[model samples]
Target chain A: MSEAIAPALLAPGRTAGMNWRRLVPLLLVAPLVLFMLALYALPVLAMLSRSLLEPAPTLAHYAELAGDEVFHRIFTNTLWTTLVVTAGTLVLGYPVAMGLARARTLLPLLLIIVLLPFWTSVLVRSYAWMVLLGRHGLVNEALLAMGMLDRPLRILNTPLAVHIAMVHILLPYMILPIANALRQIDPSLARAAAGLGAGPWAVFRQVTLPLSMPGVMAGILLVFVLSLGFYITPALVGGPRDMTLSMLIAQRVEQLDWAYAATLSAVLLATALVIIAIFQRAFGVGTAFRMSAR
Target chain B: MTLAGRGASVALNSLEKRYEGFGAVRGVSIDIRSGEFLTLLGPSGSGKTTTLMMIAGFETPSAGDIAIDGRSVVALPAHRRNIGMVFQNYALFPHLTVAENIGFPLKQRGVAKAERARLVEEALELVRLPGYGTRQPRQLSGGQQQRVALARAIVFKPRLLLMDEPLGALDKQLRESLQLEMRRLHADLGITFIYVTHDQEEALTMSDRIAVMHEGRVAQIGPPEELYDRPENRFVAAFIGESNFLPATVRGREEGHVVAECAGSLVRATCTTNPAPGESVTLAARPERLRFVDGGWPAPPPANRLAVTVTEAVFVGERCRYVLRTGDGTSLVLKEPSSAATRRRVAGETAEVAWSVADTILV
Candidate 1:
């Protein structure tokens, strides 16, 4: 009896074979995971450790960050820039994302327009903005030709220029997630809302907006986190007084102040992680990433 | 319980819907009385759901006038029409709690907090889900989610309630139970219910009136028994239930019935249309109306008897279906109770199937 039961219970596909098949997926992923650990994880860990260990194993770097007025001002500037960029992208990208998701005939065209920026490198795009927004650039020329402006206007090398260029670079990131979220929502939900005596505005405010929260949260997180560590675009287009923390980190590294540079990088990384943790708690992590309302 | 005459009567006058010159619903004129349960029954793309959508103001009609309570509402949008609708997928808000979902309409109407809470609780209790208010819709089972959808649709007490295949997504057993519950609710509330379904049995069981649609037009509209027993055309006869059409030519007419020649025999059938002699006609009869008798072909064959060879006898639970073919190879089906008598005739045997002359329907 035991022999018969054991042979039947250990059916190949249900027992040993199934376990082996499961392990096959893990084995397939091993190479990529090991490569990431070696090249990415090691360097980030080393940089974070040097913030406490370079010259001495002390909390002095953090203490300096706590007290330094220049660091404080730069930190505030980084926060301000991230907030403005995130808000601007959300307000501008929302309608475009909605049109992309809902349009029947223009979807391919909208998609191409939204993704065209990604085909070009970010550095080239920043130079293109410089040429476009320059004192005598095409935008100014067009405006002057159309008699829409009195002068070419001081458009480049200002905080506004930095914001405009950053938003243009990050708008696609904001739009894609929101468009995906909106598309996942069943049109029947809106129809049901309308049938239940809700006006157009009410249906949008109550059904469409609430159902798209996951995408909005994702866009905010991606844009805000990306803005926090932005370096080159701001450095090229921003005024001197609009220096962010990433610029300070670069300046310190150029001066061979490794401890302060490592500290700044570590602080930025920690800030991003803290923000993610808070948002994950406020909006469940599943909802933050889930495409469907369910 | 407070709803009765408050329900609006809907009248569609020559309603027509055209899409790029193709008519989805063509010149459909129906007068739906207040507090009546009417079902639009048809196969998919037969324009039943399309008609319901037009009545709900989701699909604008190209040519028609729809009046609710004697006032034309074709120009009004869906929201202003004050209609409640339940979708096939039960579109409950996934993020909202059961109570919040039920309270959504009341909140939209600007009802106060205490009143909204009371109404939500009442609705939850009405749907037999009193303590499940705080649970999210995703946490509920499929049946519970459907109950919440029904509750949400009715919480505002709209003038008309439209359901588009609301139970089509449920399992058969659950669908039957919900059908009964829906009928009970319709009776208790006394509100007009315009339901759409492709299931014939569901329409027969719940509807006070059913409009059978075919090819964008209403083939027949009447009470369930009338549609089942006296279908207006061949499409209605075949669509409502299983039927066998026997072709014949009109021979003569009597006081209330017409005599037609079918397979070298005269078959007396009740015809809705007055057919002239020598005009072609088709006679239809349900399978259960036919019975098998001993003998292949008797001398002076009976008025409603046909010579058929039993090809297949399928025993299905309480009844057996016998597939038969005549000498000309025209197929006929006979359904009889699976008793000792019906078991005697096996396949590949000759049998005579008979029905009453009155049972033959001329289409």
Candidate 2:
């Protein structure tokens, strides 16, 4: 029995030929890579081709983007509005993130609140904002009752309503990453800082803020990138003069101008890639992805 | 280069620390002299670390006060207290290099850049890492990182330096080397160092005095030799060093010694604390104090002797430790020089163990 078992348990180096057996299962899923190439990559390539080649291969779409006063206004307006919304989301989200990170009893409730809006459709949330921010909505009614305003105020159909709705919707995305980052930081680090002659504000400024940078950068990138692609909220709550690039793309698509719509989509995609590159350069891409994943 | 200022004195007058409803540190009072290297030595959960934290102003005392330089600092924040602290993990900022970490206190004090750099270099050299200022903590070895932490603690020349298990992370060899360096630094600078460590050898190696703590109170506070030679209680005797405690009953008393009957053997020991006649007591003896002899070996000149059978013999490079059982089946350990002559004893052989009355401590 010993002799038989010895042969059965021969050294792994003597049985190197069996190593290929481990790869059999992985080989079975190799076809999924081909499927992605066919379905996802082919569509993206077709979109790129259409953006450049459609309506008689020319750079006119790119050239027209620079001189078109309306397109320039929409682009700049979208950039400024997205920046404002991203900043607003960060400022409002940090305290909530700190609360979630520090308060063990409130974490579950805060998580539910953060995810509650995600449960509904974006269109539904935007419409709900329209109802709340309209001239005769709950806010104006409360303000009139408190004698803060003499009449019902026009808060909806303006950039202010769009900013509020965007910030509210994107707050979860900003907060979760910051909270995850804060959680990874060792509480002992702050204590050590305080023990090593740092006041509360200095500890926050030097240790807490620097250590939580990856989270802040990640939240800003996510909120800013998401805000750039926002469509439904701005359309429902913003005035026609406050239309963003996304709304312009939708208008062109609705007018059956697919070539111009594809050009606008390309511009949006390029802008997002450029912003992401800048963010990745500022803070490592790996850290950003880690924060988002958490 | 030379000691210029007298080190700060630290006094904890009945300091207490509580967490929620539980007291982590009970009433504890200690007076640490200026320019002394004092260590708080204890096992985990003994509240030594909590006491240190309270003195450093990281944790507020629930009941009493900590005074530095004879002034109450209980209400002072950590930064304003001007106490330098080295954490167990070193707690070096990963975002900053060694220079920046060492210069942190100087920056907080608003010291000029040139003066900060000069002091940072001097501190680095004091820890013997003169050229490692540019490296991040992660880039250095554990001992080097620990030195950087020490440098950071002393860069601003704080009068009091608090170290919490600073050498606990290093290996035995590195720890021993750093312990010697710390001793030299303490002697050279004449700075008040309140070090906390559970390692008794480290406390003995570097401290001017050791405060052995157990269960939220100081078991004993004395110089290293005093703690080792004359431990005040059973806990301090066992905690500070290897000690064999034999239950004994006091038979008579001399001028300053107690004659006791231990395990069917008559012995006399110097009393650490006075005990009355016929009172039960414990006779503690250091292992190295116990002398060994072969069964047929002649009696020594003037030492208390007891016959015992060798149960086990262990060769520990520098010493040969023998576990022996006495006539009453009580086990005691004795260490002899690890020469070839001492290795001749075998288990199950009878031997004589002897020590002087002065070396045995009666508790």
Candidate 3:
């Protein structure tokens, strides 16, 4: 066993003979590797292969998708909604994350509150948004009773409703990473800034904000990539004019156009990966993380 | 040398800080001289750091006032006070390059960009970190980071500078080197530096005066030698250095010295804190002050003598420490420089220890 399993200590630059020690690591991960290859990668490859080889070995589906006016609108709509939802969650979550980092005694309860939304089903949460955003929903009815509204507001099935629901769903993803980052900051940095003649606002703008960039980048990456493929919230809450790439893919699949649906899915996956690459280029996570090292 | 500061004198009057019925500092007052380095030295929770924080305008005193150069700054916020402070953790901004971090204070004061750059370079050179301007703080070693923090604090040319155990995080060898650098920094800048540390040696080595704090109050404040040689109270005596305490009853006053009966011997010692006759007190004598009586001694064997048995003898490189037991079962230590001329005493040997009146303090 020792002769077969031992490293090539006696002979440098030589490969070891068949070793159970080396196989142990591979054996440990074999289940997960096999599961992903069979269930995930195989299906994804089969779907993508349909875009190129289904019914005929031709690129007609991709050529049509590029020139399709409706496809362009849906693609841009998806990009626009993803950007707004990311911005919305960021603007709202940064403060909550800062508060959560500072509220040490209340941290456990606050964390539970931040993570509570994940326990609810996405379909149920989308329905809850619908009930609250309908024509005679709680918001408009309250505004009308307060004498601030002259007529019923058209809020349901709008981009605003889609934005509200998406931001609510994706907020936890934004908050957790940012709070973890904020908690890692050496609090004395702010005090040091203040002592060095910086006012409160300058301290925040120069020290606190810059030091928390890694967390902010992580949050944006998570929320942006997640919202790019978001389907249920928008489908249940958005008007017909707010069709996204995922919605188009759903429509094509329902009409028995599997090749075009696969083409759209390929485009969505490639776009998401390209966007992530661009973000990485603009703000490398490694550099940001190293900058914050103690 | 050109960056020397016009040091501001700080006066903390009746400064008190209490949080939630717990008094962190109670009625502490100290008048700090300009260009003088004063150290607040004590154990943790002794209110040394609190006293420092109140001076830097970080903690609002529950009572009394703080004046910088005779101007009341009680209403002034920390940033408006123009006091530079170095925290215990260096506290360098992680995202900023060394130069940018140093230039931060100048930028905040609305200094022009060109001038700020020049001053940042000058400050870096002042801390011997020239050309490290573009390097981020994480790239520097712990000592280098602390020096950068020091440079940043002093670059703004604040009249006063405060430090809170800045060398506590470093190793002993690094701390010693930094201590020398700080003393030189103080001399070059000529700024009033208020430092807080629990290290007695650091306080004695660096400060023009040391304030020994205990339980929310300044137990004693004086020059290092004064605090070491003539401690006014038992706390100051015990806190500064090793002392052999002999419980005694005051016999009478003899020639401006307090005569006391201690450990089966009559002892004469200095007594600024006057003790009336028959009052119980403690006589504090440094170990080096006590000597072994031998034929080599002068005609009269000093003033006080005690019969003791050598309980233990420890050779600590330079000196031989003898732990002696008195007839009354009191243990006292006597340290003598190891010399080949004198015979060494072993445990269980009978010996007579002698010391002079001028060397002992009646506390």
Candidate 4:
């Protein structure tokens, strides 16, 4: 009797002739697929097509962008600031992530501090940094009071202000992945390295850092890509000379130069894709996004 | 790999480790000779692993000093102490290949690449993993990974090797095989090995000396046979192996042996601890040292004997084990060869158990 029931159980289609189990998941995801296609993919593709078909199907806009010296300066500025912000986040976030991974009693407190910025709006965070780095602000006032500075430093409305505010906004993005990676590493590896006569620095270089590379890579890619597209933080904190590509694209749209804006957006999208493709080829995406070192 | 005269002697002078006013290891002083294979054998939280960590310099002692070759190394960090440690999890670097993992210490010490390769290859061969240099740690089985961990620890030829339950992760069969392999490696390298394990059989099978720890103290430390045959206290006797502890009253002392009255019978056991007459004592006897007397065979005239009722008789391959209850309801276990003479005694039958004076000790 059990043997007779076994084949019927195995052949579910024999009874219903339909596999709703498989179809249910596809049906469940169909709405998301349609939503993304309608809301995200179509508009982006339509905007990209304008770069080719706009101004009577001429590539003149892209040529103009390439030859324009102001565009070149803003593009270089964007790249430099993005690189600086990415590097700054890495250097500032690594030790905090390491501390979070190893902390026993202070873990929750440190985690809360790392995550506090995420609770606030990005605009608010940028404005807060503007206040802190502004002339006659708290830092300048303190420095002046301490007699350490002869005059108020021009910290706000410069490339330095943009870099600092962007780093502050994107630091949690850098820290969380690295902390997750560091947490996944077995602590025995460090002890084992030490036991084999590697000092603290050697242990970190040999074991801890190498194992945490995936998270580090993830943080770098996320921070760099996000910083490349930063608009309000740079616009609010940056001086006129520190104009970024995103700010320029926004300005072109406001001026009703839709063709130029589309061309610039296409360039930004292409650059992001090329950067991702280079990194993906250099280190497999699987390694970069791996959840655990093991 | 040959070592230089088995490394240095380690002396832990009254080592104490207290965590927030609670003692983890209290007053542990052990003098390990050069090249000695000393195993700190104890149950979990018994301070054996803590003691090993202190010697490895991973944990600082709250008080007391540790010395290598009579020179204090308490202030030295782990890397400067020249000690090799094999963690229970193996702790192999997942990112490095087996060869790179084995050669990591050599690289850290600034050895040339060519020489590092030679030494790594030799270490791999020593651990019986030659030609497996390119394999990742995840590609290997548990036993293979264990061997890689051992190779990595010993490749640097450190003065001492500390293994914290290296075989704890393997199955019983694999653990047994690895125990023999580790013993062989210790012999070949002639380096001091301080091994930690909670398994009694593993300790007995591997170590030249076993320190049985209990409640943050060493209950007994001696050669395996000596520890097994003559444990110092009740904890040691019970922890090292199975034992029957019976409450007894000391009747008298004669020739350094105590005559104790227990379970309506008189037992004469050797007593290192002198108990006055009429004082309460405990007599410990191993099951193998006791046998049942039946009708077919005559009972041996031993110094200690008890009249017990056989409550259960179990056939355990080569032998039969009988759980017996004495007249005063004191339970005892007796083991005898599974011969025709012993097979007749079943549950609910009366039997006379006997043991020699030397086999039973007063604790």
Interface RMSD of 4: 0.8
Q: Each prediction's Cα lDDT score? A: 0.88, 0.87, 0.89, 0.90
Per-residue lDDT of model 4, residues A101-160, tens digit only = 999899999989999998999999988988898997888999999999999999999999
Worst 10 residues of 4 chain B by lDDT: B292-301
Native contact share for candidate 1: 0.80
Query: lDDT tens digits, residues B258-334, model 2?
Result: 88888777888987577777888888998888887442234553356788999998888888888999888889998
Residue lDDT tens for model 1, A1-294? 663354456553457656665677899999999999999999999988888997879899999899999999999999999999999999999999899889889899889999999788889989999999889988899999999999888878889999999999999989999999999888988888788778999998999988888999999999999999999889888889889999999999999998999999999999999989989999975787887554
Error of 2 at A206 (Å): 2.1
Candidate 2, after superposition: displacement of residue B185 in Å?
1.4
Residue range B111-208, candidate 4, lDDT tens digits: 99999999999999998999999999999999999999999888989878999999998999999999999988998999999999999999999999
- List where candidate 4 sits over 4 angstroms from the true fold: A1-28, B295-301, B339-341
| lDDT score for candidate 4 against the true structure | 0.90
Pairs in clash, predicted candidate 2: none
Worst 10 residues of 1 chain A by lDDT: A3-12
Can you give the DockQ of every candidate in the order shown?
0.73, 0.65, 0.77, 0.81
Model 4: colliding residue pairs: none
Q: Compared to the true structure, candidate 4 yields what TM-score?
A: 0.95
- The per-residue C-alpha lDDT of model 2 at residue B76 equals 93
Off by over 4 Å in 1: A1-22, A292-294, B294-303, B341-343
| Per-model TM values vs. the true structure | 0.94, 0.92, 0.95, 0.95
- Model 3 TM-score is 0.95
